[model samples]
Target: MADLVFTVFTSLDSYIEKPGGVFAPPPWSDEVGEAWSNAALARAQHLIYGRVNFEFNKGFWSAAETDPNSIAAGIDYAPKMNALPKTVMSRTLTGDPGWNGRIAGPDIAAEVARLKRDVTGGDIFAFSGAGAAETLFGADLVDEFWLMITPQLFGDGKPLFREGRPESTMRLVECRPLDVGSVILRYRRASEG
Candidate 1:
């Protein structure tokens, strides 16, 4: 069985959104790209996302794969990301996602559990935020959380953790600060401690 890992990028204030409607920080850097790529490659067997995030990433990274002038790490990362098997959880998206991906049904939790059982290697990683993150968290299916805390903060933005979900506990696995001001905090379900 595979573990389900939810990896998210957040601002210092715990917001997952930027000044614009983007999720990742603007003016991407090689350092950030390298960190993200390394982390993703370390244990990800399947990449999962919500429909909206799936489309956005498909457009951006697909273009990055062909952009000769793109950052070195980003250029390298794009192909790896694009080639990875993906599952987009959406009810409305029809047919193919134009990438190596398929649309998952409405039952996010059950689908995630099925993926966990089906995988033969590595972990099932969801680079998630907002609705997708909330669904997985509320379902109590996330085995681990890997959060990257950027140095900046947004006064008002989409929060990583929302209200209404029952309170849960986590066991700290690791805390590492990157060369940049960004920090990575890793945790697992408290029951696994």
Candidate 2:
């Protein structure tokens, strides 16, 4: 079975986005981007997202794949990202999701659980989908977490985890610091360790 990995880029204080709904810019040096791309390519076989993030990523990365002027175009990231299969978890979103994507059925947890059972050997990544992450985390379906934390802190913003979440233990698997002062932390469910 595949591991369901909840991955996010956050500020030092664990905010996934700044106060104005804007994301904190990723600390991307060429070396950092390369390493990130390599790791992404090595592990992820499927991608999951919330409606908002799904649309944003589709627009951004689709353009980045062909637009030489795009910041991410120079890196190997864009094409790989665009090529992956994506599932968008949204009840309100109708019709085609575009960009090699599909709308997940009403039951978020069930869909993810099905993916976990079917997709063998690789990881199913929940990328920047706060709601989806929370749902999967709550369902006890999340097997790993990959958090990339930038050096700066957002005093207040959207947090990765909210109040009243179930308690669970994690074992640190890797901690790598980037040249840009960002750190990538990987954790697996403690039972798996």
Candidate 3:
């Protein structure tokens, strides 16, 4: 079975985005970018937002397949995110055959759980900010969280946690600081009460 992982780029002040829905492009230094690039590829199975994030990532990653110096080339996530079984949670999207995606209307929980049972190995990862992250978290379906904390602080903006966390908790399993002030933190969901 595959593990459910949610990863995001968050500022030190606990904001995923600045006011007006603006986001900092991830720092892609040779070392840091390479690390993040490989980290994403390891997830293997990608569960993503249907429209905005999908279009954005699809453009960059699909291009990385050819661009040598691009971070996409180093990680090899393009083909992985494209080829691996994926479920895009969206009511507004009509999954195009070109992207090899399916339109999942309602029954979001049922669909996610089904995908979990379907995958033999690897992992299912949710990308982007509060909206999609909150949905999966509220459903209590996420098994692990890989948060990349950037050094900058947005003061007040987008946040990761909202209401309806199921009264559960997580135990910090790992923490590593990169060359830059940004850090990588990993947590595993604690057993449910």
Candidate 4:
């Protein structure tokens, strides 16, 4: 079965977004993190996202591909991101979600489980959406977590690990520091370890 890897980019305090719903790259974000992300994306057979993140990413990356002046236009992973098949978990979004994507059914957990059982060769990567991640976490469907933790703190914001998730031990698979002072941590469910 394909492993479901939830990848998150957060502040040291674990907040994924700043207050007021601002979504910006961490101050310490650099090429090292980008390279690491590219490698992970390269290994993903399918990309998954929550509705908000999916829409934001599609708008940015799709525009980048066509806009030569776009900051992300030259990024190595831009094309791969656009080309990869994506499943957006959403109940309100209808029709095509663009950029080689589809809207998932109402049952999010079941759809994710089906992907884990059917997809082969590479793993499924969840790039964003804490709510979706929490749902997957609660259902015991997430196999791994790849977190990029920056040094700064948001004080208060949208946390990646929210309340009500089932308590489970995580095995530290890898830890590496980037030149920009950000740290990359990989963890697997201890039960699987």
Q: Largest lDDT belongs to which candidate? A: 4
Candidate 2 lDDT for residue 122: 86
Instruction: lDDT winner between 1 and 3, please give it.
Output: 1
| lDDT, candidate 4, 62-181, per-residue tens | 977789888679776788888888998887889997889999898878899899898898999987677777777777778898888888889988888877778888999999888888
Per-residue lDDT, model 4, residue 10, is 91
**Considering every candidate listed, which one attains the maximal TM-score?**
4
lDDT by residue (tens digit), candidate 3, 1-193:
7777788878888888888888676565666765665776665565656456766767766666667787767664456765655566665766472455666558768877777788665777777567777778778878888888888878887786777778767888778788887788888877622
* Model 2 misplacement above 4 A: 64-72
TM-score of each: 0.88, 0.91, 0.85, 0.92
Which structure is stronger by TM-score: 1 or 3?
1
TM-score of 3: 0.85
Superposed Cα deviation of residue 63, candidate 2 (Å): 1.9
Give lDDT tens digits, candidate 1, residues 118-177: 977699999765888888878878889888888887887788998877678899988877
Clashes of each: 0, 0, 0, 0
- Candidate 2 lDDT by residue in tens digits, 1-193: 8888887888999898888787677878886766665786679889998888998888888987678898668656678788888889887889888998999998877898888888766889887566766776777777888888899889998888887667889999999999999999999988895
Return the clash pairs for model 2, or none.
none
**How many clashing pairs does model 2 include?**
0
For each candidate, the alpha-carbon lDDT, in order, equals 0.80, 0.83, 0.71, 0.84
